[model samples]
Target: MKFQIQRDRLVNGVNDVMKAVSSRTTIPILTGIKIMAHEEGVTLTGSDSDISIESFIPKEEDGKEIVNIQQAGGIVLQAKFFEGIVKKLPMDTVEIEVHSHLQTVIRSGKSEFNLNGLDVTEYPHLPQIEEDSVLKIETNLLKTIIRQTVFAVSTSETRPILTGVNWHIENGELNCVATDSHRLAMRKAPISGGNGDKSEAVIPGKSLNELNKILEDTSDELEIVITENQVLFKAKHVLFFSRLLEGNYPDTSRLVPAESKTSLTIGGKEFLQAIDRASLLAREERNNVVRLSISEEGGVEISSNTPEIGKVVEEIQRKSTDGEALNISFSAKYMMDALKVFEGAETNIQFTGAMRPFVLRTTSDDTILQLITPVRTY
Candidate 1:
């Protein structure tokens, strides 16, 4: 392989693919990035079995040359050294050439380095996913759906399925749900260009988080294809693939309450601040529990206490209170996380009882919901 590519574009493509490279991978070649220089462009790929990412830099975009190719071939370079060298290259262009016996040469300006490249053919092939049946979603909306739910995925390995977010697409709408048994988050959005095939996939939370970081914030549409065991996300110049979790995600529809016994409408900012302050004391406790008390006369108070630490009590006004007066305790971290996604909008919280799971939603939008189980306190 012989090619000269713009330094900036090469750096970006390297960074994107590097997210999937892991040194601890069992297959030695998986720690290296496969670089293929073809007639059309230069393609870089990285994978660790669970996730694979490929980024392509076209030879010319918008009539401007991005890569100048002299020969067509492929080679695998150690990701750690290649990534570091590309980032620190002294010039605006980088030249790579492969000689016999897999010896590679990298040059930029007056700098030169020789690397022993691996056989690209030894790298595992990515899953073959047909794109005929795909759903399209706006990049920004897809990121929103991930941010609104991926955090709620269980960190524990006890129930492996709980470590992923469940995605269901049907009826021209997509629903994403994640839960850790203590808290749940759900987001719904409309999709386009689907073949009307009902599809379900459990995507590992870690994969979605990484994809969110790589995706640009734009109105451009992203293509998603879910097969029996692998999921593909295709964006401009990038392709991401992840293995679907193998177990069936637990059914969570029945967990949401049909109705509420106590409901409170409060300023999201005020409630978040009160809980944040209260958590300062509760932070010393095991669960970081904060207590909320509501009075029939529409008074609201947040309090937290730790015998070793001090107690914190704060009063916040509610926009409206309905149903029964109630007191409930919950993890301060969970509440704060849910509130941050609301983006300071007015919040409506519905509590079925003191001990039941409570739901939170923004008054302006009903497409997203957050639920947290109240902590039992003596």
Candidate 2:
């Protein structure tokens, strides 16, 4: 197999596929990237049995040629070495050729590297998914959804299901929810076109994060095909597949209170910055807890204490305050995470009581809301 591709294009393709490469795998070939050069373009694939990413560089994009394929063949090359080689290449183009006996060679500028390649036949076959169950979403919107929720997913393996983001589509609305027991993030958006059929899937947070990193064009839409155990995100020139978590995601709708006893409307940035500064002192504590006290007449105050490292107390003028006064303690890190997701000028926070989970959202928008369980400071 032999092909010449623009150095920049190949570098991007390698970077995209490398997201799925695992160095420590039972199957050695899984540690490498499978490269296939065909008549249309060159396809690069990487997988670790859980998440798989494939990037295709076509022969020509627009009026320029991105790749020229001389011979059609497939082989696997070590991802670690190939990634480094492509990035360091000092030229406008890169040439890859594989000879008999699995001898692979890479050349660019004044540098050439020869490495042994694995037979493509030994590579595990990527899942073949049907398009019967498919949903389309804007790339940027999907990225934002992942960014806003995946941070709340549990990093612990104790409850494996909590490590995934739950997605459900019904009545032309798509909702995504992620929680780690302590805090939860949920976003709801209207699907441009839908049949109103209900479908749900729990995708691993790690996979969504990786896919979000590779999605470059927000204007482009991607199709998602769901199977019994797998979900596929099909983009313009990239295909991402992730295995769905086995267990069901816990129902958390009841966790959000319909009414609140305390409410405060404050600037999102100002509130987030206050928590950010307060966390410095709270960081020394085990849970990085910060206390928020709100008064109908005195506005809101954020404070944190570290016995040995001093403490910090700051106040942000509230746009409006109502209901009962609140004295709540919560993880500073969790509050910051929720605040950063709010892009609007101000956010409204509601507290049912001192010990209840607080919900945060923009007053003008109800599509996305975040819930935070306060830490008991007794």
Best by TM-score: 1
lDDT of 1: 0.95
Candidate 1 residues 1-378, lDDT tens each?
899999999999999999999999999999999999999999999999999999999999998999999999999999999999999999999999999999999999999999999999988999999878988999999999999999999999999999999999889999999999999999999998878989899999999998998999999999999889999999999999999999889899999999999999999998898898899888644689999999888789999989887898888988999999999999999999999989889999999999999999999999999999999998
Score every model by TM-score: 0.99, 0.97
Q: How far in Å is the alpha carbon of 315 misplaced in model 1?
A: 0.4
| Per-residue alpha-carbon lDDT of candidate 2 for residues 1-378, written as tens digits (9 for 90 to 100) | 999999999999999999999998999999999999999999999999999999999999888999999999999999999899999999999999999899999999889999899999999999988777567788888888888899999999999999999998887788999999999999997665445578899999999989999998567878888888999998999999999999889999999999999888898988888888899888644799999998767578999988888999898777888898789999988888899899645999988999999999988778889999999888
For model 1, which pairs clash?
none
Assess the local accuracy of residue 272 in candidate 2 as a C-alpha lDDT between 0 and 100: 84
Which regions of candidate 1 are displaced past 4 Å? none
Q: What clash pairs does model 2 have?
A: none
